[model samples]
Target chain A: MTKRKMFLRMITASLLRRRSRMLIALLSIAVGATILSGLVTIYIDVPRQMGAQFRSYGANMIILPGEEGSLTGAVLEEAMQVIPSENIVGATPYRYVRLDMPSRQQSFTTAGTDFDEVRKTSPYFSVEGEYPQNRREIMVGKEVAETIGVRLGSSIELSYKPLASFEGEASADWVPGAALLGSSEGFNEAVLNVSAVLDEEGKISEIEVDALSQTENIGSLVGTDKAFLDQFLGKSLPLTLGEDVDALSGATISSQAVVDALNSSRSRENARLSENKEHYTVAGILSTGGEEEAYIYMSLEDLTRLTQEEIMDVAELSVSASAEELEGYAANIQEEYPALTARLVKRLAKSEASVLSKLQALVFLVTAVVLALTLICVSTTMMAVVSERRREIGLRKALGASDGSIRHEFLGEGMFLGGLGGLLGGLLGFAFAQMVSVHVFGSSITFQPLLLPITIIVSMAISAVSCQLPIKKAVAIDPAIVLKGE
Target chain B: MALLELKNISKIYGDLKALDNVSIRVEKGEWVAIMGPSGSGKSTMMNIIGCMDKPTMGEVLLSGVDISKETARSLTDIRRDKIGLIFQQFHMVTYLTAVENVMVSQYYHSMPDEEEALEALGRVGLRDRARHLPSQLSGGEQQRVCVARALINHPELILADEPTGNLDETNENIVLGLFRQLHNEGTTLIVVTHDPEVAEAAQRTIVLEHGRVAREVINENFGK
Candidate 1:
């Protein structure tokens, strides 16, 4: 019986003497703590569960340009700032353009897109051959290719249709979208930085660097193209990259590499020269098996070069937002910029909103009721304990125990009961919460480790406060009368 | 200055006066016994001396400090550090073992030590029954446990109210023998009882009648 155990023994002895009372208090406390932990777990995790459920249903929100003009890449960039960056998991812009196939002498609808964004937005894209890399190249859909009687490496002339310039308010807010995506890398400085291209023999070779457009093929500029030059210029050509060359006619030709005469490799024509063209190649074809298969792909820079319109005429933007947040996200965007219209896909958005709101309200109500019951039960039980221990209290007080010491003893007993109850309740609550989640939400719940201390503190507080009147009455007992023999 | 003094002390309950102007002094290490018939205010005086009750008038001085005017907390400290009490009913906390009951006094004073509490119980011949709860002990054994609890704090003054009221002749002899040993070692003792044998063992005897001191006498059998 050290001093510490002396204090603890007094409390435990008293509690153990009245085991039934403390056990009742403990049970009530445990029940209260369990409900408190379970409801809080459910409350915090419901949104995530609902979000996952909604994602399984498909696209949540879409952003369309204002009627005054089509959406620019600048507006898209600003829109990105307003929306949460991580939440916008996928985004792709669409612009419908027209093309003229000279073989048929008729125009057809051509959709312009960023193929990378399209891949994330629609995962179903299945490729046959390759997608187009530049303005001069195009990936003809199976139906379109069959109609045009074209195969791989087939290039069709695209009709030039410039974006109609927006005036007043819409154009006033625009930033050049094409400039945002284009890099301003200096070719001369870049070439100087490349120390050497090593060969298998460990010898160093100096390599020439050429500035290539987004549409240009980097392979065409790498090695000597004398064979290509001869085939294109209709004569055996001499290489004149570093110095002037004399064509067979004895005329001195000042040299810069010149690429001449182009035709699609798969075209039926023997040789049809192009008036003006970009270095282009087919990268890969996307066959989504859906309507996205019909859309042709190209970068915004390629579109600007081909149409001579330095604008991003994005008709619509597909934004990725979670179902629970879609409505709020759209509202935030509409509030910030009144020009744009945000439409919910409505496939699962309505259901997600309704379920989340009701869930939070129900959790709040259940937690409140349980807390009230716990407080009442713990308080009543502690009061009874104090009442039954009046003689013991009076004896201790007579033995030189101060009023404060008496109060601490009883409060310690209450808190000990509370802590025991809380431990039991925390475990019970985690199990209950997990079970509820599995049964109702078909998901596992997360446990908040912080609840253990909180439950014990709360229980102790309630029990101490409840035991006050009884303890005070006990403290006021006259030791003289209690000890006086009858 | 006397180690314990009661000056013009009076206790009243509405119209009834339990004590009236009772004054007495006991020197350091003196053993005194208080004896009286029913309604003689013997118990009331003990209560006042132990700081368990405040007198209606006059004062109690211990070590030259008037304790009757002190606050409840100070009185509690006085009872804890300076005075120990033993009741006829034993008043051992029922749920605690005999050793734990002894430790309770030490706990209230400063610190409780198992060795000190066990030694105190051994002094009263209850060492073998140290782990027995009050309900499990005989009346004599219970009284011995109470004595051990009172002695555990090494109080300056010990007030025994009917100390052997419930004990057999053999247990009474054992208790008196322990008090004789304590008196030989110079511990102040106050025994309140109707038993003449208990009163005769003390150095002085004070007799009360109708809340007043009827007579007081020095005892010849204190050490004998």
Candidate 2:
């Protein structure tokens, strides 16, 4: 037999004598190796998937009115002129009102806009019933429909609270109470017809108002309310009706205040939407399974009106250029529009990559722990084998076996265990990763081919570490005492 | 010049003396028997002569080189290259076949020859049983295998510690006959035993009492 063959045979014979004990050690090493391989595979893939999921939600940028901080028509016109028209798909100005759904006691903030432009900008809205073709039809969010007991073809009674501010009496110093009806000025309310119910596609919702009322014709109604105040030029009076809470409540103005705050926020969001018409649109309503679904949608123009902010707040313009050109575009935009910030949000497959990285880290940690523990087991097993064969070792020493030969024998045994376990672990780890991915990520996972080499290398390292201690112990055995039992 | 020599050899275990100032010498081609009752330190003397153990205070000169000054490792080399050992129980590795047991001795030598192993086995009349494992061989056959193993390296010194002690009369006689044949071939031989019959088989006998050499005599008609 060749020297190597003889050495291997010695190891095999020794291991075979105690196969049962060694099998457990082998299994432990294999398990550790498998986990290492599988987890590493996942760590490399998560970011790309996550990034894709985020991209699916279209709002990569937001635009606001100019630094002048005014929503004047002239300002909007100037902003529009500055941005190229070909880049802007749709734009509409927005106005908002606070409405209280008395039946459900739910507050809905409404955004008034040109529905034609709004529909064109936001296409993800899944309308259960046909959308309104004219100004009278109003689309409602699905959560609002469920709460207010209103559906398509149903006319919902929405009371829009009129502003109770007394004009020309230091209007800037006026703080309106919660109840408009019981306040110094009487409450103003209006009603609208529900045209369609929209599913939760990509809707924006606030905490207080229901999402359905975002599209109510709040502008025309608020304008009319202001016209009514123009009629009664100067009046400060608190008007109380009969003992009917439904008709007029006192402290329910907080709900109206919530609706107002929601409306103002929605209008501002709309202005930003219009300002960045190229990058964003009214995707859909965010139902969130809560009472606060009251939100608004607008075309890019309407967002510009409501937000009353700078053009930089709204528009995200992308030039038809290569990756290298993106830096130049950003630089040019920065220099030309010094007030505006241009960021290159690369559509990186980061989400999937991050998921992969995390999975990789987890896999590495698990593998390390497994291999460490297995090394301990292997070390123990080797120690036992060495101790058990002290007499044999001494006899071999006496019979002229070199220290290298003895050490080689034990190393061969360790490597055999490691390699065997690694092979088994690699196969098992692949299956394990597949199972975890399918169960956790809810998708089928592709097996990475590289895990095989990684598993083998890791297993070998574990065996090498595990064998060192026992090999040292074996080397320390005194030949004379061991052989003659002196 | 003596092929093997011991001067003032003594071995002490705590306060008790296992061997006290035991001195002996054997020239080339001589068969010497060391006889003693149990605990007379005959086994200890054999161990020292076989290089299996070192004396506490003594000089073991093999071919005129004092081995007491050699390191334990170098002593092992000396044992492997110069002396061949046989045990009372025929300590052939049981797992190996008869020929393999003989070949095992050659492992210590730098150049092991298969033909030399076969010839050694043939000298001990164990050539026919060469393929049989130690357990499969008869008692006499096992002793012959052990003898073959000891002689395979053709060492200058052969130390047999009660080689036929565990054997029947016929096997003992066969083993003794093999030894006589090997001695005639000019190999120095030392046999440690308490059996008078075994001692009578040797050309000279050394008697020990109380860990000391009591007497040494050359038989006029040894094995006649």
Candidate 1 ranges with C-alpha deviation above 4 Å: A1-5, A16-18, A50-60, A63-324, A327-341, A345-362, B217-224
Tens digit of lDDT per residue, candidate 2, span B1-224? 89888999999999989999988889888999999898888877876776767999999999998997776667778888888777665655545567766665675465445577778888887777777866798888888887887777778988887888889999998988888888888888998888888998899999998899989978778757
* Per-prediction DockQ: 0.44, 0.21
**Candidate maximizing TM-score:** 1
DockQ of 2: 0.21
Query: Model 1: which residue pairs collide?
Result: A126-A287, A130-A284, A130-A285, A131-A284, A131-A285
Cα lDDT, model 2, residue B173: 88
The sequence of per-residue lDDT tens digits that candidate 1 reaches over residues A48-75 is: 7666555544456667776664576677
On DockQ, the candidate that comes out on top is: 1
TM-scores for candidates 1 onward, in order: 0.62, 0.61
